[model samples]
Target: MNSLPKRIAKEIERLMKEPVPGIQAVPHDDNLRYFDVSIEGPTQSPFEGGNFKLELFLPEEYPMAPPKVRFLNKIYHPNIDKLGRICLDILKDKWSPALQIRTGNFVILREKVLLSIQALLSAPNPDDPLANDVAQHWKENEPDAILTGKDIVRFSVSEKMDLGIRQAKVD
Candidate 1:
């Protein structure tokens, strides 16, 4: 069996060499099991042009256990809490020993990690959410998520809005 550190190192090396588009991973100078990743918001999504930071920690059991990832940036999203916790199935209830830290053309890597993150951006999982207010806002305001992408651009441009402004603030 591959030791946890070795497995994590290999995964980090792979991510560094051939990073997923919009996502880059870098290891800490003294921590091999922990890595810093930056994921660009998917194009045409609420996070478009927004850069988000994530901290990934591969535990002692690695492949047998899912890596823990927490948002390091303050992102106001339905699936992410104010404290930066992410509510994703793979990181929680759906984690499996088969999944690994990769975003290449493979089930464990691509499908489980990158695809899921994209899906989260496309459709926040309000049913199981870490941020209650964000979820409620998303559920109540039928078109918020789709409209949110444009809002980011608008906020940067003029910071003026006639409507949907209340929904933007998760408070």
Candidate 2:
């Protein structure tokens, strides 16, 4: 409880001063530990021309534990589940206490996740996926899967789905 707040405050200050490329994150005024985040879809991925929203919270154990993060925007990715839960090793079983920063409680939150997800966008790992059907589809028919993912992006935009990243603000 003590370390978490101080850490989060430092994190907010850092991010505000040096925002990450393609990603912007800010903590809510009402809840210092809960952040509203946005990540631009990578340029060459099916999600390009889009913005993705996410919510991240520092748990009580914090650096000793990973932040609870989930996508608020729907995306067509094999490593992301229907509920927007991710199957990334860093976010899960591989999380390291060394990720903790003496500077902030946020860990290297935005950078690591952004880079990894960007990499995932460029080169999806279908062998291990949170969305099983999508993974199987990718494995069985790579080209068709790519086509379908692209189609989904187009349709979602036309349909005005809640796929756009929510503006970062105190909520």
Candidate 3:
């Protein structure tokens, strides 16, 4: 990896000094541009009580280009595919060079990628989904789909434990 950009370095430092609630993003020692992330499922959501693992990588063109982010663990959500590709607008055409990893109080909450993803878990948009089947399920039988999502999280957590994969801990 090349040297970290000044903007990214400052963002990383702020992330460490003033951590976001229920979210953690730690850069790997070998690659500062890559982060190992964990987001605790939002309260009152189907994903509640689950800790989701994800990977985020700031590409060479970073703020001008949105960071690449995807779930490392399986999650049953309409907007998230089996491969963990997210269908969030900010990660796509809405991306802007002015966007920051963490935003100030006045900024629109969804403008922050990580916060948007966390909010996605709380309010999934089945109408515009990345996983067609999951979206169909969500649209057809909403209650059942929610149950399935909760079950998938429980199963994934157990599987992680069986494999000795440590869950990320936020301070």
Candidate 4:
């Protein structure tokens, strides 16, 4: 039927075959419209050395409505909230159905957006932040903010890893 769900499944299949380096996303068998993704932190970024997880879900009205994407791993990005919601323009006000009509075009756009997100992690834009307090600190003192950001990133990720190890030991 080439419905939204079908198109998402097709795109996800192609992504699996030609996967991006350091980024992995695959459909959940129980929910083809929902994707489980993991992005390796980019080198030299504050998020570097941390393994981050994310989820992307295609809403029923997707293409007309932007996909719902959020970080599952704790991150300290100004553009991302503690709950994992992102404040990216393309995922918000800039979505257009034309971008997803042709499967090939959709693939390209998806890749581009992913790359842009990676870049965002490498160099956060404090001026356009979703986390207001973090943004304020970043704007007032850039160097200190970077340090604090890295500290938070390290702490959050390490805590998650520790919890995982504990669970493994318990089982």
Q: Identify the candidate with maximal TM-score.
A: 3
Clashing pairs in 4: none
TM-score-based ranking: 3, 4, 2, 1
The candidate with the higher lDDT, 2 or 3, is 3
Which candidate ranks first by lDDT, i.e. highest? 3
Q: Distance from true position, residue 27, model 3, in Å?
A: 0.2
Q: Rank candidates, lDDT, best first.
A: 3, 4, 2, 1
Question: Residue-wise lDDT of candidate 4 within 34-59, one digit each (tens)?
Answer: 87877877998777877778888878
lDDT of 2 by residue, 113-156 (tens): 65676667767789998899999999999888877777766776
Candidate 4: worst-modelled 10 consecutive residues by lDDT: 103-112
Worst 10 residues of 1 by lDDT: 102-111
What TM-score does candidate 4 get on C-alpha atoms?
0.83
Q: Please, what are the lDDT tens digits per residue for candidate 3 over residues 13-85?
A: 7777777889888889999888898999999999998999999988998767888999988899999998989
The lowest-lDDT stretch of 10 consecutive residues in candidate 3 is 102-111
lDDT of each: 0.68, 0.75, 0.84, 0.76
Q: On TM-score, who's better, 3 or 4? A: 3
What's the CA error at residue 74 for candidate 4, in Å?
2.2
